[model samples]
Target: MTSPGSIRRIRRIDLRRSALTGGPVDYRRAVPRAEFDVEAAVDIVKPITDAVRERGVEAILEFNARFDGVEQTEIRVPVEVLHRALEKLAPEIRAALEESIARLRATCQAELETDAVTELGPGARVTHRKVPVGRVGLYVPGGLAPLVSSVVMNVVPAQVAGVESIALASPPQKEFGGLPHPSILAACALLGVEEVYAVGGAQAIAMFAYGVEASATTEGCERVDLVTGPGNIYVVTAKRVLKGQVGIDSEAGPTEIAILADDTADAAYVAADLISQAEHDPLAAAVLVTSSERLADEVEAELDKQVSVTKHAERIGISLSGSQSGIVLVDDVEQGIDVVNAYAAEHLEIHTQNPDVAASRIRNAGAIFVGPHAPVSLGDYCAGSNHVLPTGGCACHSSGLSVRAFTKSVHVVDYSREGLAAVRDHVVTLAEAEDLPGHGAAVSVRFSEPSPVESGETTP
Candidate 1:
């Protein structure tokens, strides 16, 4: 239920001329935080993570029943059900998922890369090998939206990375016999991955990383090396707590997007982008830092018009009304860029005419979309780049999941006698300088014994 006043803030297109002034959005008061209790949620998740880590499969099952309302002793989702799921799906959804997968594949191919090798010295050479993790765990959020698009977003990149195994975990629906939505199961089958689990939350993450129950075992069953995708705060916390025991992608938080537009920008386009991100969850932050008061006014009006028609009208209303979402008028485009940089958003769209230049000036963002044509939604689905990204201001220091997220490098040594001799003095000098006599002794051992040729020289 969006209040009349809340709806009034949206500047409709009929009132478009109000945005031309190019004013400033108050940085201090742009968005509010009524229900985004990230700190509290993180605190609560620590216990859940520890419980799952200590109790393993049983704890996960308990959380599944408690949170998702589906109880199961084991976590496996059978193949028969998965096959039937596609048939049960509406044709429109089936077609959409198929198209999205194809589009995403093309995008991933462009972003994925292979490793390289180089030689530093005559005998010292190094090579980088792009090896995928033996196993990866993907947690898809289900409490709110079905997140069928997320199925493609996560698995495609891991598949592109050549990860040997991908284990998917989604909450079980009672209406579906604790099975994931048929669309999701169909997606798993479509991707050619067979290991699926009907589980969710912090517990599901634990089962994947720590290996719970006699349930998920295979012929060569083992714990996963890396876990990815998005979930609620509890899931994010579990990943944080268990990071040392297993690898984790960025710890995501409430979704957020920052749009930078100029006076020439379409108010409708700007408003739609902001509202789309807002609909993800009530806590998602949608911001437009623009140089046009008239544009802001019109976008606010456009938001009022389009928001009424959104499918998730309740969520859309809550998100739009939430303090975390609003239009900010900046002094100019340069100040807008600085505000965006300071925020370090997960998704950023530059809609100004010189979008490339604006994008170039951006210092921090998980993903950047340039021009009106490349909206954040494209990246969320069919854009070849990965969608799982660092969030909650973390883009300042981290990055999104990609092919490189699954690999690690270790130095290999292949020193020959000559190679060892070539660096003996340097090693000895450094070792002696560091007061490590044993290090020098180790290098000196090769020269400790005299060569037989010395005897011939003495006889001569």
Candidate 2:
């Protein structure tokens, strides 16, 4: 396998000199195609999902042994273990988690919307009421890095939306005796999430979509109404295939960052942010769309200096050199903005003379970090913003995971006798126009007056 340290060169694009139009600057040269083919992945994971659906927990345990290299006697984590993990958590880490929960809670509360009632006319009204999903499954990745913070991001919003039943799943750790990372368990405990599983990847999602049978002390896993959180392509693929069976947040692909900067931006700060996101994975994208060539050159040198000493230096190097990661030189900040919007990065940072002004014009991005003081890393952990966002250009249409993702919007219509009479003719006309006589008959019968019963005495 090629190591990250050997990767030394990152590509650069000069849009100002090229014949590229802002209309559709082909990103084939700049953006790397995702490694996972959802179509092919569908075939690969179909059997696994089928097995889970057929055999339930038995198939889950078998897959766990075959893939994760861990044999679980019991998949469901016990309540006492969760509490113990929290008690043993580091004091500083515990404090930080508490703060994150507080911020997310406060923000989520503000996002909670009330039912909206619209008065079409007297005695005729329509209501848009928001209701929480009954149950949810949160998947936290245990590969590459143990994402303990994801626990807070996924659970808090669901809790705020008042989801009654919440279950969490993470890949079991061999070093930790077939349980998820201790920190993951601890975060779950802190969030008061009692149900957790030692399953990961497609199998974990499968287990959530199709409830597993009761095996050992683990009560049978109940199928969730919705699943939310970021995961690998397989996890994403499972969500895609099982979308109707259960709702999903988004098909989150590889993480990415795009920084729009100018001459006034700090090269060191820009370089550090790019390196920070690159540390995520070899496929992670770190893009720099800047108006200043001097700034780009300086940032490149800064990336070289910064990537060398990082703990995940090899991974960072590979990511920076990948086609997906590069610097794009635009004619000016206006052109740079156009490129960033087209790229639609998952995390977009503005480091220009007037970052707020520049940020205001951005049409698409999962999250915008304004000014040099704000970084994507802060949003990932504690920016009071949900980091579970749309990825792989999905930000153009979809939104980041939030309270809205967990709730369903339903419209309630009410009409009185007078209201029905007023619109009865319109409804009948439309229904007849569509050649659906049954629809018109149903409405016409409601308006039809009952025949007067024959009385013994004649009307006076």
Candidate 3:
């Protein structure tokens, strides 16, 4: 850990000074973001995906040996192993995971949408139905942390959405005899998922996209309809490369948090929240945008004091001092809202006198925690909300993983002869205008007289 007094201070950006100059500020450009390039990694990831496509399990074993530093002949984990892991799980930890699962399941149940039928007129009806994906591959990071909670986050929604088949993958640990972390396996067991693999990194994603052929020693792994979860840059790049072959939730980048606080916010609470996210990785972003300069100064001091004693001080220090993480000074709470909206952080926390009012104005965010009492860490585990959210300003266009992500919307149209006749003229006119007479002919032929064959006459 870094020395208490030597911890680096978080940098500051003074947007208030820019506002005073009476010049327009491009908030998006002014905001700090991590330098993430998924496209540049295509050359490195494409070969691995191709190899998995051709060689199947052979290529997966090679990549696992090279990246995960574990040697195993078979990738699929046995059902007995999953049971053993759950059997050995500590009582307290098991209780905590069970509670988290129940809470998330409840939320997912409430989010389920029912089919809706609409009648345009007599004999014309349309129905919108929600269909769940058949199968899904959920990846859990086992690098810095096991992230056992991720199993619950990904599985509960997929299960709640009525997905039938679920497969999970995590890196193999040499210390655990070439198996994934025991906690991860236990969580899978608890969720009633029988298909688990001890694979990791970009190769695991390829295994899901192309699938592995059955070998003499290993059973075949079938391809999944969709893949969801969070992982490192390499895993994210693989998802980007093999997107069309298999569906992906999003190209998730590094974790990030943006706190919109004011003079009423407690400095200690603000400082601790920033450090919590920074502990995830050196690339994680922890930003503070506040109107009160006094609050900003206090947050900085609190960060310096708290980071020095934390177990991951060295890692947190690097993230806090990096270009992606900083403190931005705004003119007032209103300006602070604009800065945060433009930032579109993965997690946005509102800390003001009226957090509800501030939260209502927010137009873009993966998830909003309204008040100092509700922290990002709560959502990560047992807050009944998903932690698999979009990063790198993706919240502006996308959303966090939920029951809806695992389902597809299909429109069912029903029409009678009368319904067809009602719109026949309009269809003919529009089709002719667009030079697509075939579309109109299909409708017109339905109403026209039957052909000789349809009338039971044989052609000569």
TM-score top scorer: 3
lDDT of 2 by residue, 1-460 (tens): 1234467666788787465656765643354433546777898888998899999888888999998899878899989999999999999999999999999899999999999999888878899999999999999999999999999999999999999999999999999999999999999999999999999999999999988889765667999999998898889999998888888999998899999999999999999998889888988988889889899889988887787788998988888888678888888899888888888889999998999999999989999999999999999888899999888888889999899999999999998766777888999899999999899898887657642432244456
Where in model 1 is the C-alpha error above 4 Å?
1-39, 90-92, 215-221, 450-460
lDDT of 3 by residue, 1-460 (tens): 1334465678899899655566788887787888789989888999999999999999988998998888888999999999999999999999999999999999999999999999988878999999999999999999988999999999999999999999999999989989999999999999999999999988999999988998887777899999999999889999999999999999898899999999999999999999999999989999999999999989988887888889988889988888999999998889999999999999999999999999999988999999989999999999999999999999999999999999999999998777877888999999999999999999999768865655777878
How well does candidate 2 score on lDDT at residue 304? 74
Query: Which residue pairs collide, candidate 3?
Result: none
TM-score of each: 0.87, 0.95, 0.96
Question: How do these models rank on TM-score, best leading?
Answer: 3, 2, 1
Tens-digit lDDT track for model 1 on 1-460? 2433344242221112354445644433333322445556767777777786677766777787888888675678777777777667788877877888887777666766655666655676566666778899988888777888888888887888778888898888888777877778888877777889888887777777778646454221247999999988888877877888889987888888889899989888887888788889978888788888888778877877788788876677777766676666666898788778877888999999799999999888999999999988888876766778888777989989776776666555656556777888999999999999999999898677855553344653
lDDT values of the candidates? 0.77, 0.88, 0.92
Q: Model 2: which residue pairs collide? A: none
- Name the weakest run of 10 consecutive residues (lDDT summed) in model 2: 450-459
Error of 2 at 103 (Å): 0.8
Candidate 3: segments with Cα more than 4 A from true spot: 1-7, 17-22, 450-460
The candidate 1 region of ten consecutive residues with least summed lDDT is 8-17
What TM-score would candidate 3 get against the native?
A: 0.96
